[model samples]
Target: MTDQKFDIIVYGASSFVGQIMTRYMHEQFADESISWAIAGRSKSKLETLSKDIGLSDIEILVADASDESALKMMCERGKVVISTVGPYALYGDTLVKVCAESGTHYCDLTGEPQWIRKMQDRYESVAQKTGALIVHCCGFDSIPSDLGVHFLQQHALKKFGQTCSQINMRVAKLKGGASGGTIASIINMVKEAAGDAELRRQLKDPYSLCPPDHSFSARQRDVKMAYDEEYDSWIAPFVMAAINTRVVHRSNAMTGNNYGTDFLYEEAMVTGKDGRGKRMARATAWGMNAFMVGLAIPPVRWLLENHILPKPGEGPSEKEQLEGEYDLRFFGKTSAGDKIKCRVTGDRDPGYGSTAKMLAQAAACLAQDVPEGAVGGFWTPASILGDKLIERLREHAGLTFDLE
Candidate 1:
């Protein structure tokens, strides 16, 4: 691995989020500081992205998602590979396989739990043996949630002598627009769940991604719409909670159940404390439910894919991305009745701008911070990257994880 030519490779560099990440990397890292490159199936697209981002000197590696030999060759040359190509169930298998077999560290912006489970089942052993540190959900869907829990729990342990037994993450403010790539992943997940009863069941399980031998059987709570006196707000179901909660649980499990086997976690968006807030909560819940149901139906799904949602490579403009932001509040309680509060905020759009930065920092952390011969297998952002990544995010990714 020391002989690898590049420290990091940005796979799918010409994709929507990929392009954003490339620009970020160009601005953040000096040539002497890190050896990284851009990669995708299209040489022309990669070249254009490099030119557009003013990354004139960055190397470009071309490899299609399905080409095993090319992917293997690409994987073997990079210590860490950051994948922006997603709807991962469809296009991410080969790259992950190659990386796992070649002992390359990997991270991605995928939020697809089912696809993550598939990859874990198929490649976990190989990765473990080869010492490939594969981490997922390095993007908006779960990073803030997962690492927010971690940040709070660490403070809880230090202040109260124990971890939080229950934690609730409330999105107080989230302003962002989704790209076609994000919507496509959601649609593919729904389409899979609609056809597979087992998948639907797994999707509902909060610990679906935990190790098979784990003993977590706690019944997790789901908020449809409710008034919370604690925060003085009306809460609605969070669309990303399904995957985020699972990632958090898996992180707990992977960390030797540091959060306790019976730890409870939930995520929701907070509406204001008023009649209008309650109405908004109900509407948000209803809208989310309707969207999922519509996606399950073939005709409605087609309509959404073809006419409603953004297409691949289409997303919010640079202005919207730069102006967007999120404020996530975490309220935690230890078993001894001690309380802790914290918040995680980002200065850019959650889906594209913030996600791109978070993913880049995660990959860089994997490349530069994680020491060689660390226990390796599938990992969540918080479980593997932990404080190292939190530091990077605060310093360079325009994110704040602070106690309130």
Candidate 2:
């Protein structure tokens, strides 16, 4: 809207997830008419990606997220900025500020609750005043989880004559690998756990993901999530813990709590193989909890921080995450026998594959084609775009959210 030089500008397009976003952009707009460019801190890596990804004709721009002037210049050139750089707490805030200050809408594939929440507090007011809609968690941690629940709530109102008070999402069947960037994110999270006790605790509160009084539709129920034996399948506790569920709730809150005051939410991964898989998943979760707790310890935290996770300047290879995939199922039910369920299946892995599509479309849609008057400022993919993003996903990416 500001007469920017480009419709959209992608930041960190040379990083692990960023490269995938760049490729998606190539395939999606190969012959289309879209004024866009790839940008990163390194012109060489950007050029190499351009050659490797077969986008030699496309121009590559250089802008380090840490460099304020360069970042603001990039933001000034695009109606929206799509960011793929992450462990966002470390390298993201500066761009977010620039986008907000420049009135350039922003979006990213971030599942890090601590960082998302921090941005809301530090930039929400500025974003609101400047008309920048800063959206995070556009990927697996909550896109499907967030958008899927929005579908359930809408479906409930239309058919059940009542909104669901509780909804449960589980991993039905999935196979995938992690990107080095994803690995780097996990390692950094572990290291952060070692340093900040409050962050680990804040991530537990479902309402903590958004700005205060934002009214997220659901809340984290303090109950042991387990498999449903009656379904004859194993369902382990949710992997995202409060991250995904809280985001969905935040969407609900941001949308005026349209679902209801007493909405409930939880999510999990699927397990089977005579329930052995479920047991193993539970065991794995137990280990993860222990590891997170261990990371919080003084001596253990120091060792993990220094030896395990890569330092800020390092991360995973782009090739690895692009090869991964993630699938999920969300089952919603009413107080009676009424029931409805949906599945989120992605062609790419959740961390990278699915995220690439989600992030690219997020910026493109926000800039080029999204319907007008969708509430601006900090938002969830569903809360702002609602069916708008779902349609984009189906048309632009091999993503599916089907009801059964």
Candidate 3:
């Protein structure tokens, strides 16, 4: 490869989550050998951010999302590009295309299933051919879920002589607020699927991210609010399961079903262990379900977009972010009936503080630690970064993965 301007270019470094991610990389990689820079649509904002964060020496590149030529140029300059600009369905389409064609690695914090499906269909082959590893949902929405499964299965194989035939991820604890950009993506997803029957179908498919030839033998659960005899707690469907489950399944598909062809997975939040807990779980689940349906309604969506929810470039305060934390528990059952458990926890808020660090470390892992001979294609975190990223998260991102 020709000498590039930097090792990685953070493409949306002026936005809320983007700002956190840039500041994070700046502090963490402060005397490191890695070369990196920040880029965004506003040169002045990028300059101001550089000074505010005390990284004025780092170069800033200006490029609008719609400018394909500029995006392609940006892609060519960085070995990897970290994009935080979202409701990706609106802003990410062209950038992924340019990155795929330019043979540049890309990662984004997108949780929109329909848009991801479209990108996979349109760019998977091109990305594979051009040696670009495009990965998505490398954030709180899925990384903990994806990599938790990965960590569990590895230990399951070692202890049980086989991978898990089924895995369940429980969001045991989480203290964080969602980013406005994340809220926008959810609203856009609801709106897009409401009008497109095919998109709706894909959204509901557990194996939507799997290839056409893929088949499974395990029976997946119909994710919903329910009582769990195992944990003795009331469990509610996780809002992020719709996205994280697909990423986990995609990891299995991309890895040639390394976990197993019949592998099954589920994700949910655990309430408490009594009747009141069950009531609360059902209430929370049904409330979120209704909220999703409401967002699908034009009037409700308009009200939320205009009045209720925070807009893009807005999110929780630094105090709230620093106070955020999450704990996930994974239960795995091997084909032989052997069982194992694992946990993944984060010290920062799940949505902003943790997500920003996870995305940055994911990009850094790809740029520095990917195995030789790994080709580019649409990939999930478990299938691409795996242990290297797990290590990075633990060492630098306030994330820990431990087997129980």
- For lDDT, the strongest prediction is 1
Residue 393's lDDT within candidate 3 is: 91
Candidate 3 residue pairs in clash (backbone atoms < 3 Å): none
TM-scores vs. true structure, each candidate = 0.98, 0.89, 0.97
1-404 per-residue lDDT for model 3 (tens digits): 33565778999999899999988999888986678989989999999999999995798888999999989778878999999999899999999999999889999999988888899999999999999999999999789999999999888878878899899888899898767888898888887788889888887788888776788656678667888877779899888888999999989988889988878899889999888888989898899988988898899889989998988888879999999999999988888888899999999999899999999999998899989999889989999899899998999999999988
Per-candidate count of clashing residue pairs (backbone under 3 Å) = 0, 8, 0
The C-alpha lDDT values of all candidates are: 0.92, 0.74, 0.89
lDDT of 1 by residue, 211-261 (tens): 999888888999899988889999999988988999999999999999999
Candidate 2: the clashing residue pairs are: 179-321, 180-316, 215-253, 216-249, 216-253, 217-253, 324-349, 325-349
Candidate 3 segments exceeding 4 Å error: 1-3
lDDT per residue as tens, model 2, 1-404? 43447877888888777877788888888776577888889999998998998886676778887999999878888888888887787889899999888888888877777778888888888888888888887777677888888887788778989777778777775555534454446656666765687877875677787557654444356434365653556665655655787787778788777766667787766667575876776786786677667765768866766887545434335454455556777777776757887777777666667777888877777876666764457888888878878888888877787887
Candidate 1: residue pairs that collide: none
